[model samples]
Target: MRLNQFISHHSKYSRREADRLIEEGRVNIEKNKADFNTVLEVGQRVFIDGKYLKAQNQDLYTVIVYHKPKGEIVSKKDDRDRRIVYDTLGAKYAHFISVGRLDFASEGLLLLTDSKNVARQLMQSDLEREYILKIKGSVTKEMIEAMEKGLSLQNATLGAHHKSKIKAMDFAPFLKYEVTKEGTNFSRLKVSITEGKNRELRRFFAYFKREVVDLRRVRYGWIELNALPVGKIRFLNKTEYKLLHQFLSKNDKNFYVSKKYI
Candidate 1:
């Protein structure tokens, strides 16, 4: 595994924070400063600020589904001093890192995991995310068709003003969609996408000069936010954990439960 992944999986640090620690010269392997992509050997000694980081106990893992509320950042720490998801969950679960992001204004179905590999695998997997979005303008058949068919969005359309070499015609396929409400100005719709890109759903409508007024993810993978009140955090049930483990362990099928940490 990469140094960042190894550190995050074994320590309380998230992958991003692990990278930051490496960059800040706090992490060392064999008396050498570690880089984010440094490969970790089975018995390699890794020290963070002179303290050794033990290899992760593969058996001990915790994953939770959080019903995130609007106005809360997904990060554990924010400079803006705004209420973050960790604040709601409190310090007890501070070690959990969000699987993917729900922007400050968006809400619902946020996944948090203590296992760095699980977090990485889920985001890169073919799991679909279902979202219920409220927009300020009504969506027409043509607009929906364009979205379903995929748009040739320019970098500027995606707000990438600096990189002109990026292709404008990358296809972003929507798995499913439904118009929940159609009004004179506002509209509510449910859409699903297998691939999650940074702000892709919001930017999809923005390509046509329309903005998503409100966005909430109601489902992710096989997990649904059923009866979970907003801002509540719950551990994945046994069946849910099995399903997630099956999906995440497709490539590495040697998941063992450890009693070392819980």
Candidate 2:
């Protein structure tokens, strides 16, 4: 592995912090000063600031899926005194961090992991997430086509800034969507996307002049919410973990058959 990746995988410092240490001449491999791109072989001794660092602990990792409920925040502490996900999770999971966040009004499948490297890799990977939403009213086929083709929205908050600083952005390349159920005044649909931009789904509906009455992320990557009760937590089975690791590494469409660890 690259030296900086190794450092961040094994230590508290992040990859950027490790690069800074390398630039400052504080990292060494086998008694020689190391560089950011240095390749580290297994069993090679590593030192940081003249102190020996241990090899990466492949087994000391944890990844869990938490069933977040609506009205509960994804953070550990909330100044508004609303319920937080960590408060629902037992003490055993206090050290883990949520992979991504669900806003106060939205909830569903959320991931928690003890490994920062795993979390970071998965976040940057092109893994798919599926959300099931209930909109306040029916959507026309034309709007669906426009959504599939993508839409652009401007940031009005930047109005106070200079025109050059005003931000306009496009959200496109939506993977797939289907209307599952329709009622007189409500509709339900499933939407899938590869990238989890901040409140992207909600914004997508808002652009069409509709409001989401209920939102739940029922699937993330290879995992599903299934029958897990709200506020419950469970570890990813070996198969799920392996698939996630492989997806992050290769971005393959075919599921890897090997049961080996990454």
Candidate 3:
């Protein structure tokens, strides 16, 4: 790795900062000041201020549950004149990414992490990432049933063979279809899918001719929003993170417990 690049990767500072550090003779390789373009061979011990970089793996993991409020744009950078999710995160984490996006018009259960490796794992695992979204419209039992039948949306199609990614999943069968309900204008649904297509949740409603006045994801993979307030963030518990990774390595027999696989 190039000295400049290695410095940039080790810290959040940009390449310019790295150049300044190297030029100022602050970085060293084996006790010698590192040149700006020093090529570090494999197994080389590089140091910054004499402190060996303790390589931190995604093995040091974090899973956060954020109740994404409506109108918040899900992006690291927003072109439109709107509030970005970073406004809330910059103060919380030294680094993080919105695991996935929730539409500006929708809210609920968004994941944030600084570990790119784990994020990649969570995003690509085929047997994971089912989210439950609560929505509202002129929907009926038939429409819900149709969701179980399948629908075509903007870019891809959803095949219905399993229960809704949206359903009553508060562990109460009596509230099987109602727990996700937020208001007369909204019906909470625990729908599960192994993949995420853009606007897929809302588009799923369109298949039933139902208009969504509001939508929010109450769950993702294995983490749940539970009673989390809108627009706030919270770190995932040990059990939640452990279960999510474990689910990824196993079969999805307990799909209801977590849309994630184990």
Candidate 4:
């Protein structure tokens, strides 16, 4: 892997910090100063500040499910001094990386892991995400068609953050959707989709001039929120771990070869 990636994955320093260290000549590979573009080979030793940076044991890692409540951003800190997920998660999970984010107005199940590889893999995977959404105004035929056939919009910023730079978005067809309730004033639905783009669901509804009043994620892949209380966290059970192992094994054959799940 690249030098920055290696340091970030094996140590607490982020990739940006790793680059800074490289630039300052504080990193070394086999007694030679490392460069920012260095690509480490297997078994190569790396040292920082005269101390060997030991690689973490691949077999040992932890994953937890946190029931995130609305109004908290999924970040370490916010410029506006708003609450972040880590604040509610406490210092115990201060170093854990969130698998994906739930926007400030959205809530529900969120996954976090101590291993960066696990977080990255799960976030990038095409696993289905199920959500329970309450939107203003009745669900219309245009919305149904867009959800079924998918949509490509050049101006998808109606529901996005004002600072967001993404103007165009391509939405894939939803895996499934059920209109649980429909009315002139509001509507509720359960929908499943594979992609996890930024403000995807909200943008889709906004394209039809509908507002998403409440959006809550209920499930991701085989993981479910179930009866988990808001703001609480729970570790993955044996079956869930097994399923995760299988998924990792399929994605990277060398990832979990010891037949161990933690």
Q: Report the Cα RMSD per candidate.
A: 4.3, 6.0, 9.3, 2.3
Weakest 10 consecutive residues of candidate 3 by summed lDDT = 167-176
lDDT of each: 0.80, 0.77, 0.62, 0.92
lDDT order, best first, reads 4, 1, 2, 3
lDDT of 1 by residue, 91-194 (tens): 88888878989887888899998877778778787788999988878788767887688766655255222323443545466888899999878989999988
> By TM-score, how accurate is candidate 2?
0.71
Per-model TM-score versus the true fold: 0.79, 0.71, 0.62, 0.90
Q: Which ten residues in a row have the lowest lDDT in candidate 4?
A: 253-262
* Winner by TM-score: 4
Q: Where does the lowest 10-residue lDDT sum fall in candidate 1?
A: 156-165
Tell me how many clashing residue pairs each candidate has.
2, 0, 15, 0
TM-score of 4: 0.90
Off by over 4 Å in 4: 23-52
| Candidate 1 Cα errors over 4 Å, as ranges | 1-6, 14-52, 156-171, 253-262
Candidate 4 overall lDDT versus native: 0.92
User: Would you give me the overall lDDT of model 1?
Assistant: 0.80
> Model 2 Cα displacement at 41 (Å)?
17
TM-score, predicted candidate 1 vs. hidden true structure: 0.79
Which structure is stronger by TM-score: 1 or 4? 4
For 200-243, candidate 4 gives per-residue lDDT tens digits of 99999999999999999999999999999999999999889989
**Maximum-lDDT candidate:** 4
